[model samples]
Target chain A: MARQPLRKVGSTWKPPGKPAGQAQAQDPAGSKGEAALVAGLRAGDAKAFEEVVLRYGPRLLIVGRRILGNEEDARDCVQETFLATHRSIGEFQGRSNLGTWLRRIVTNAALMKLRARRTRPEESIEEFLPKYDPNLFRGGPRNANALTPEELLQRADTRKLVQEAIDRIPGSYRTVLLLRDFEGYSTQETAQLLDTTDGAIKVRLHRARTAMKELLAPLFDEELR
Target chain B: MREFLLKLLLQFRGDKDPGPTEQRVGSWMLRHLPGMLTCPEFEEFIHDYYEGLLSAKVRRRFETHMQLCPMCQVHFDSYVRAIALGRQVCSDDEQLPEGMPQELVAAILLARNQDLDS
Candidate 1:
């Protein structure tokens, strides 16, 4: 007869009344709250996971939309991102801000999705073209004397032009610019998210900005003069 | 004062590389061009004067320079194009290619969660 395995159920599992992670503890002493929550999560406390989702859901949504270029996909990415984050909570090495680590995961997920759905083959030359020519403006002095707001809206179509320029950038460069310029991530933050060095992010961002400058030249030719 | 200003302007002069001046201007332009150039108010009257957005008095003076200045014209045109293109590329309304289905989001999440549990 083999010895019966010890059935120490009550000790290994959390108390029935305790909130699933470190969150139920006192107000976090500095970073201790997050640390506690992470610990609870490691212990399989479900509530700790919920707190993580609540904290990051909105920020991640914006990131997803910018990366994926659509609202619905962004929302989907957030949900999946949190779930994945939850699964890997045990292995989280605590070497980074949880937000940064989670963001890295979300960014990778978004990139993977883009890669999977993209129709173009990897490394195709045609993917590098400026998506639209910036010469859409009719050549002529815009009638400046027309002072009405409606007239300006009709003639300028400023919003549409901006979108077209963004569309024209190559994929990697485009994502870098979007993260830096639109989403307001720092060079270091973006580097972490993309899993690249800060030097690489800087180089890519410079190229993106230069490309953006070319696209915008026609619009501002008059202003700079 | 006018003589000093002219000397300063000469360092940014269109005919030559202006070397360091161009780099400074490039950095300044990168940050501010988006806001400064997008106004239709400036775009409408840009062609009447070579330096489209300069004050009338300033434009009157630059006009004389531009008459013989091909470099200024080309550089100015390139800047204009860049601002216009920047606005277009970053605009929000641009459509995305079709995305993963809602079901896929669920499937992926569920699969990941299950893996964690196991």
Candidate 2:
């Protein structure tokens, strides 16, 4: 198979020595798999419950982290998610993938905790992207008036700018963006985890990236100007 | 290109197992060089829109903004590719548990085979 290129934007794709250890697409558990697990749990098969728990544990942790914001709270959220999952197995009805169902339970648990603590929504959607003003940096692409090495170094400092911008974003936008963008959750999965619609996930993601860009305006000023 | 870099940095900031959020975001942005050459407006929308968080109206506005912005479209594409690559990296590194949960597997099998009458 032709290796996928890790091309930079505006550049044609080129094959780099393939980097290793990529995660696979998340496959929802089949009905048969769910049925088996449900049967085992219903039959008081302790081992079966353990299997389900093990399979879904890390994902549960990731979802919990987004909502709870700390590993300790996230761990508690995972436990609660499983406990609820076990209690509700008989009633699962196989309507959704087991992982989706579990994620729903975990998200609800974390949201409830967030609500109880009155965790404030951190940044508005517009504020999530990094900030830059185009009028200030209106030089055309061919202009080479400002390429001194030291000044160029400042323009190169993109990572720092991007980081600071993310730091400024509201926690709600951060969570959704991280889950969808960083953690590789599908819009549907994110919606399930966030208890929102897929349309909502797309909007949050778009806004979050835009806000991040705004936050990093200084980084762009040197390069674009 | 500028938008693409931001999207990559935004979504995959932590996946490199970067020690901190700051480090992750910084490292990712630095890695994608020269792409920032283009001045992109979608970048502004990305950061500004997020400050408002999750109001229903903001969601609508964000969508509307994307529909109108060409730069954001390119950024969105890069963001998606970066995500796919990150997942690939994570998947290859993960170590599966030694065996399938035997009890869980058995339970699922039993459930599938079970007849209410039996």
Candidate 3:
């Protein structure tokens, strides 16, 4: 007997539950819309490509700005991100959320830009970290008093100060701090994004947090008094 | 005799005490402080402690040490504040800068369309 070719059950393949285009049209940035967006991109649908850029372009630029710290470089990074995503859309396995995948791409692009621009010798993080005595007791200025109501009222300014302090840290630690603390990426995710070990991520995160505290100590101590 | 009189007058005026010079670690805390973990050791575990990754035994010891060591406590508090501030700054979506550049969008679309054609 001659063998007969078997036909697949469904003519059209879609992600489990709900058509992607409809869901995405209702809420473009939501995860439900991601499948349809991915499908459209895979199919080379011009409208899908336009929608992806229109929806995520501004947010991705913000991410790039945070990492690169310059408007022009950030813009360049985001541009590269969209182009790279377009070229590599076929390789996107949908293992992570679309936003996360895009974020990882932008982070890598910004880091590359930063690396290319690092012509001078980088400064040591020690200067920004807290000093400890021989016994390992922190020896910097102390503030035993908690934040008062008046001090708490300056939270907005404090946030800006914190962002400034973050910008001052060395790029290596700064990236880790931004990804882990600012972006709320898990240690594992940050490590994967940076192509480093989990242990390295944890160590850098600890040092970065400690350095940030040291940098902000003067401001906080003044408020305490 | 003059010094004694001044001290007595200050006491009577309720100004002799310098007030509490910040909260010192109580004697009870000192008695319970971990003898094994030094400041450096405790410092190394701070990240794990904050992330809730420390084992129960280590966490107990770290907490005990924190109770007795005002310096470490202050460091820990500052670390917490730093994390909180970072989160606060990051979460304030209002601080997001202006929208994406128009030219960049056009460039991306052009590149993507060219790729599709090829």
CAPRI classification of candidate 1:
incorrect
Q: Can you write out model 3's per-residue Cα lDDT over A64-98, one digit (the tens) per residue?
A: 88888898899888878988988899889987767
The chain B TM-scores of all candidates, as shown, are 0.35, 0.35, 0.65
Complex DockQ per candidate: 0.09, 0.06, 0.22
Sorted by DockQ (best first), the order is 3, 1, 2
Residue A91 CA displacement from its true place in model 2, Å: 1.9
Each prediction's whole-model lDDT (CA): 0.51, 0.51, 0.68
Clashes of each: 31, 64, 0
Q: Each model's TM-score, in the order given? A: 0.47, 0.48, 0.76
Output the TM-score of candidate 1: 0.47
The reply for model 1, stretches above 4 Å from the true place, is A1-33, A121-164, A179-204, A218-225, B1-118
Q: Give the DockQ-based CAPRI class for model 3.
A: incorrect
Candidate number that wins on DockQ, 2 or 3: 3
Clashing pairs in 3: none
For every model in order, the TM-score on chain A comes to 0.57, 0.59, 0.76
